[model samples]
Target: MNRRTLLTGLASLPVLPLFSGFTLAADSPLSAQPPTRLAHPPSYWRDKVSAEAWKVLFEEATERPGSSPLDQFYEPGNYLCAACYLPLFRSEDKYDSGTGWPSFTQPIEGALGTKLDFRLLWPRTEYHCARCGGHQGHVFNDGPAPLGKRWCNNGVALRFVPADQPLPPLRG
Candidate 1:
């Protein structure tokens, strides 16, 4: 099915309470500290990221599910915000949710900020990078045990840094 058709169908479905009252906790010691916030307008990121990434990060557009190679990518690395390079998630939290997009069980503490989204005619928790305020994705409760939270992310909105390599400096 097309993206519009799929999203339309999703909008018609009942909103679940999976995301209600959910909070993020640090999964490891490395994630204990949050990145400092960056004060840059969305336009500042337009030239830094690809057109498609710009749409997802700044325009709050969702990419088609299963379109991101990160969906199947399992590696020892970190996932940073594509727009500002803030480390958002660790590789250990990555998992297969069979939802096409990259899924995580948790995020680095203080790495994201969420607000209620009503674009679908229902309340959904939309998360963004805490540093640059770039849209990342939504968080849901349907996930593995312990936390039972799924951090569904747009692959285009993220840049993976393999564990063997040094992370690039954060961009504006």
Candidate 2:
């Protein structure tokens, strides 16, 4: 089954503490990344996306990429959190992995946390945001060269920032 279906099926069952393992160390490169920060919650996307998206990003749930338009976003743009517009993944870091959802080789340092996901029977690794703790997607060993990592993300949980604009400094 696809990752989303697996996630849904897993949700129907009780969660084990061990199911949430696979933490990247605080000093991990991803942990050193930056993102847009807000003192309060977002008003725009709070009312923009469907209820499911709200449940996923805001509530730290997962959204299936098949249901999210973001899966097809190959344009050069930044990926922001749908619920908060926090810049997460940039288009430059993205590449076509033919993995159904948006895929990236890198994220801004310190923006994401990696953990082990057992939802698929196999011990797969997953990553999410540090600030929002929203489910982004899984990391597979089978990816393009150099980095050799694929960060598969749920499109519904992300927003696109066109490459034409300069990204703001990540919040400290």
Candidate 3:
């Protein structure tokens, strides 16, 4: 009808595709992304994890930068969720991001899930262990070549198993 109305409608068309797979709930800012369910109960995890691991994984607290020795730890091994023992990152993918945290170029296939984080008033892709839904870290674009994805992780949340050792069986 009106020129202004027509222009507004056209501009909005591009945004519709961005929301294609996500639905806004009636009462929350949360997208269609649902909370990842874990096989073990909260009590089970609480009993299994250290207080620091519990803070980072379940409470979503970030460890102090350079606090984890895992950042300098380069042994061939798998990085697993401290709470559930799920293998999340490979030693090969891990690198010296110099960000004071353990960094990986990518996660093991099918081992991670991501959601938006708005803590700093900016949106960031926060990823978690797909199996136990434990918060591992945020993935950023600043990383070495190839994938260029910096999966910055909290050392408190990860348990590294050296190549010489066998990974513990996955917890249900």
* Most lDDT-accurate candidate: 1
The lDDT of each candidate is: 0.83, 0.65, 0.76
RMSD values for the candidates in order, in angstroms, are 7.0, 7.4, 8.3
Residue pairs in clash, model 2: 21-116, 22-115, 22-116, 30-110, 31-110, 32-109, 32-110, 33-109, 33-110
- The ten-residue window of minimal lDDT in model 2 covers 13-22
Query: Whole-model lDDT for model 2 versus the true structure?
Result: 0.65
**Candidate 3 local lDDT, 1-172, one digit each (tens):** 6878767755553232222222222221223443344666456788788989988887788999999999999889899989878788899989998889999887776566666676974456777766677788898888888766788999999999998999998775
**TM per model?**
0.81, 0.66, 0.78
Error (Å) of candidate 1 at residue 16 is 18
Q: Write the per-residue lDDT of candidate 2 for residues 51-134, one digit (tens) a residue.
A: 777676555566654665666667787887665456778777788777677788877676666666667595666776665556
* Candidate 3 displacement at residue 162 in angstroms: 1.2
Candidate 1 per-residue lDDT over residues 31-130, each given as its tens digit = 4334666778889888899999999998999999989999999999999999888889999999999999999988887888766677976567788887
Q: Which 10 consecutive residues of model 1 have the lowest summed lDDT?
A: 19-28
Comparing 2 and 3 by lDDT, which wins? 3
Q: Supply the global lDDT for candidate 1.
A: 0.83
